[model samples]
Target: MEVFIRHQDKNKRKEEAVNFFIEHKTNSYISHSEIMSGRAKSTTEWSENFADILSAELDEDDCNLITIEDIHNKIIGIAILRIYRKYLIIEDMIVDGSLRGMSLGKKLMDFIHNFAAEQKIKALFLESGINNDKAHSFFEKNGFEKVSVTYIKTLSE
Candidate 1:
């Protein structure tokens, strides 16, 4: 299937993007730190606030909200990227759950790679939930290395 990746026009596509995100949020996870800090107790809670967060990011200069669409112009994937001095961080990335096995995710990653290369960014970084082995495998297959492990300890208040 042919798909195109582009920077999302928030004014025109925010709602569609949010809806698509909500639909696929189940495939994502809330980090242990988020849960321990009460920022979000679950993926559902985290995703419930996605619309507002996405809106804020859309207005940020260093944040890029990208969307991948099919030939029919339907949003099939979304990614939020934050550009830093030497690295581009993928804050969130989701491809339509129904279409998982397809090469769409790789296409999105390729787009990100080119975008970073064009901007002369040195590296790309992202984190996935510890238990998300499938996502880990996918990232590895797409040339991402397991660079670091994040450990969280809930402090007593």
Candidate 2:
């Protein structure tokens, strides 16, 4: 399939990209706070909040919402990137669940790498959920290294 990668047009594509994120987030593990608050009980409940955060990020100067689309103009993959002076952080990346194992994810990563290089950025960074082995393997295959482990402790309410 012929696919094109480009920066998302916030006005035209924010909703579609947010919907894609909601659908594919099933692969992600719920956070401790979400579990404690019972917001993880249903995808429908927290999706609105998730949508709001994602939409706002798309409008930020440092955040770049990159999207990949098929020839038919359907969005197939997305990456939420935060660019810094010396490095770029990929906050989130998702490829259509139905299209897994198709290397679309690799295409998006390659695009990010090229963009970073053009800006003279020296490194790329991202964190994946500890339980998402599939994503860890994919990141390794794409040349990402495990630089550090993130530990979080939820404070009592």
The lDDT values for all models are 0.79, 0.78
lDDT of 2 by residue, 97-150 (tens): 889888899899999999999988989988766677888899999888898875
TM-scores of the candidates are 0.85, 0.86
Clashing pairs in 1: none
Off by over 4 Å in 2: 27-48
| lDDT string, candidate 1, 43-153, tens digits | 345644656665665677776889999999999999988888989999778898889889888999999999999989999999887777778888999899998887766
Error of 2 at 1 (Å): 1.6
Strongest candidate by lDDT: 1
